[model samples]
Target: MSTAQALSPSSRAESLKKLEETELDVLVIGGGVVGAGSALDAATRGLKVGLVEARDFASGTSSRSSKLFHGGLRYLEQFNFALVFEALRERSLVLNSLCPHLAKPVPFIYPLEKLIDRPYVGLGIGVYDVMGAGRGVPSHHKHVGKKKTLESFPSGKRSAIRGSVKFYEGQVDDARHTMMLARTAAEYGALCVNSTRVIGFLREEGRVVGVKAVDLETGRAFEIRARQVINAAGVWTDEIQEMVGGRGQFQVRASKGVHLVVPRNRINSSTGIITRTEKSLLFVIPWGSHWIIGTTDTDWNLDLAHPAA
Candidate 1:
């Protein structure tokens, strides 16, 4: 069995932090990827760890992601070698070892509208696909002519689309995967409790120490002490730092991305599609009985909780 699957329910319960505990090896704030990762890493190393979140796990940017485990194709256009390589490696790990059940191969088709568009787009995508060859997902392939293209993607307007190129990428249940990370960390003995808000920081001799928090459910205050603390609150990161009485090093901007889900029959296509927009790449991802589209990225300042269309 996989390491993640081997983790039992009883082993996944948090027990490292007792109520009113005064000390711990590590305290992780924010229940997102990095925070949960730190807690799991620390706990696996035999350290007493605690992870507290003010809301449900992955209830922020993590859950609002595009849900793809891919090396961004747009990043390739900028010649970002390091970023592509790193992301490709991470994607491979996720598909092969990390969460095979949650992540799977997804084929996406790039519609070639013009005759000249094929060579240019195909060549670039070809290089990208070759780079990912032998990496967990399948290599990219192309199709031409109305018959072949229609055979591959019957839903497309054959008159508008000269042909299409088929490529494989990875998709994941982002929320489920992130929650699995938290559960895995708890299995390793990390004390994790959601709905516990961190109000302030605890200090001694002007040195950093623990956190003063309140249970949102019960409205009770408590102090969770630890030798070191990690902040992994994605968008609210700056807010957490401010409460600690320290100015943040860099500012974080909130970008809202919204996805619209429609039934698969609305846009009947054999494979998913990725098209270039003025500002961002638009993906028509297939999700079983439904197809997810949109993902409009707008500067959000009003309420980080919800993004307006």
Candidate 2:
């Protein structure tokens, strides 16, 4: 077991000094979920690892997610069974074995509109439940009539609904979860430093060596030498790749998603609601005293760092 390490000012200074001085087995860029997870994985495996973040941890798309650990119910319609299965397994691991304290099972109701909607939606959710069985959450889904559906979601329109199928999904505060991941990686002997930006890649004879970085707080430039450099910059991934003359095998595009939060009383729902839109799925998720609704997807071609909502 690894001892807990505090992400304090002293720790940050020490980490920075060590990063400037030592050579690492793996150096991770970005402080999002993927980068933090990579650092944790490397450190736990007894590899010398270092993680750097441009801004605060989870300050980008990682924190701006829908925050549900669902098994992609819509993926079933696309016949993407492998992706769905993998997501369900990861969701189970997160809720049960990984971050049980940071995540929990939340019930959601998929409301039906037409009489014919029951069997179709029910079949889908039934398959979803079966696929996710014994993975952590409740293995079965419940079907409720209109009366019970309205009872559960009193704010729902009366004329549009027929019945509902209820299923379970995991919920989390994405920011805290990601921050904890970095801290845990640090505890496992990975040097984690946020507010540090990688300006360019350090290359030797056309092979990447490490990175040239700047500490945003002090504006001090430094170099971190490592055998391998992993870029997990999320939306800013392309920028990192470009620093190396854009030789990366893949390119990344950015999408902007917007969500609205309203007081819980405005919805009058005890459970979350999922509905179908013409283009995608709509969710009215229950969060504390408020409901998180919406999520408009659009192409983002402007700023990668500070995206306007």
Candidate 3:
């Protein structure tokens, strides 16, 4: 078992306090992708940074993502051009420049059922492919007839798919990637201590300055001073903001998305698939050993400490 899995929350907290008092330029709270990225950004920018996480890294929504680092294809339907384009750029950068070893390309097959659907879906997918072409990802997706589509995916009925468009996107092991990011930030001189809970904010002159945290393992408490504090606490962002008396500019709405994992061999497919959901999109992503499926987007009002499956 990893040390992360074995460490008591109290013990983790004590270590963090000892590390935090050792001097730092920036203190980042949370250890999800955004927080970890922030720490890395601060450290790389020549700031002495410290990062504390209340749980093992990526133990939140970051690890529970769809795992695709892609330009949102469905977002095009809503005319979310800016988001799509920006994501395409970031996807390429991550796959090629940032973390090639962790991010790799995967093909997805979009099945078209009707003749008219082909032109419409093809056009949108064509634009998507073109927008991302010449990036680190593949150039263009190919259109395959029903015969080829069925040949490619043995599990689907021959009559089920009129044709299929195969496109590519990037994938990553979210947990591993997140951990590596934290590790890399630490390597660059960021003090990263997991299992340290930020109990409250240190304030002065009606402004936030630092944080008072507890070592969940040893039950010890300490204070770390910083010029600015970033709350990348995701689902708990509001709670963290409340700790500092709730004076933030933005409010977060909670949504729940659930994914199911099944053996890859159970679903015979040459590539992954995407289908339109009533509220959003559903994907059958091909993980190395399993096929990750199901994502239901709905309002969430439950215990965030344990996300409902």
Candidate 4:
């Protein structure tokens, strides 16, 4: 949203020229948060850098995440303590230090359904508190009775609200956050260019030295030389690896997810809600004056650019 930091026509032209003329220390593929963060890190370290993405920033899964930057509290039930700790720590860095402007605390109420589920759920949340202790976020959970639960979410079906547990998590405008990362890297002297597709890798004696890219808008191909190339192309990662002509260490799989946005008045909730589906958990997150309810996660086999309803 910051125009001076945005990718402009003049800036893109200058970056393309720089890519063709300068020998970079790092050439980052993909313009998602991972790619942008890599560019920022490399540029801040005083390395010459270039970033290319086939589409807009966060056009992929980076924008479609659960949108919560929390320490996966649900994972506590599975005994994944380390993962939860690590995620919460990162969440702290983002909310408290990294980019506080793009993210903030959002509260969620996990309503209890069956009478027998309280003890187990409470214990899991207890472990969540332990893992998240000392992090900037509040580690304690608020026990809410059915009366209080109804006060928070009056539109909830009566049968579903036995009681509730309130907790806090960080939420971000993912698309905006991603663009800011790319722009910040650009401000730090990384030649960040989106809508540029990597068609092939530039090689010398069986080692990758750069990339051959084409401007998606102009259809003109250009070669860029670099000491190292990083593939952060997300779902298309395997394709880049194949172009590198080597057996990949791990494969990337694409998962399709979709979110439904509804007016805030429809839910009539003071706090967001979290519920479990048969296979996964669904979040009804508070989004300003709107509520986001979503998301179906299944292996994607159709078009990568668009998914069917």
Candidate 3, residues 1-309: lDDT per residue as tens digits?
A: 122222344544544654666656788899999999998889889998888899878999889999999899878888998899999999899999989988999988888878678888888889988788748867578888988888888888676679888889999989888888887787676778886899998888987778898877677888988887889898888899899885577777888888899999999998999877677778999988899997887788998867787
Number of the top TM-score candidate:
2
**Each candidate's root-mean-square deviation in Å?**
2.7, 1.2, 3.4, 2.1
* Arranged by lDDT, best first: 2, 4, 3, 1
lDDT of 2: 0.90
Residue 120 in model 3: shift from native, Å? 1.0
lDDT of 1 by residue, 1-309 (tens): 223423333332333237255488889999887787788889889998888888878887788777889888888888996787788888889999888889998988888888788888888788777777647786556655656777867878867888777788899988888888888887776777778889999999987699898878678788988889888888888899898776678688888888998999998778889888998789999987988896897788887766666
Q: Which candidate ranks first by lDDT, i.e. highest?
A: 2
- Alpha-carbon local distance difference test for all models: 0.80, 0.90, 0.83, 0.86
Q: How many residue pairs clash in each candidate?
A: 0, 0, 9, 0
**Residue pairs of candidate 1 with colliding backbone atoms:** none
- Model 1's number of clashes is 0
Q: Which whole-number lDDT from 0 to 100 does residue 303 have in model 3?
A: 84
TM-score, prediction 2: 0.97
* RMSD after Cα superposition, model 3: 3.4
In model 4, pairs of residues that clash are none
Please, what is the TM-score per model?
A: 0.91, 0.97, 0.93, 0.94
The reply for model 2, stretches above 4 Å from the true place, is 1-3
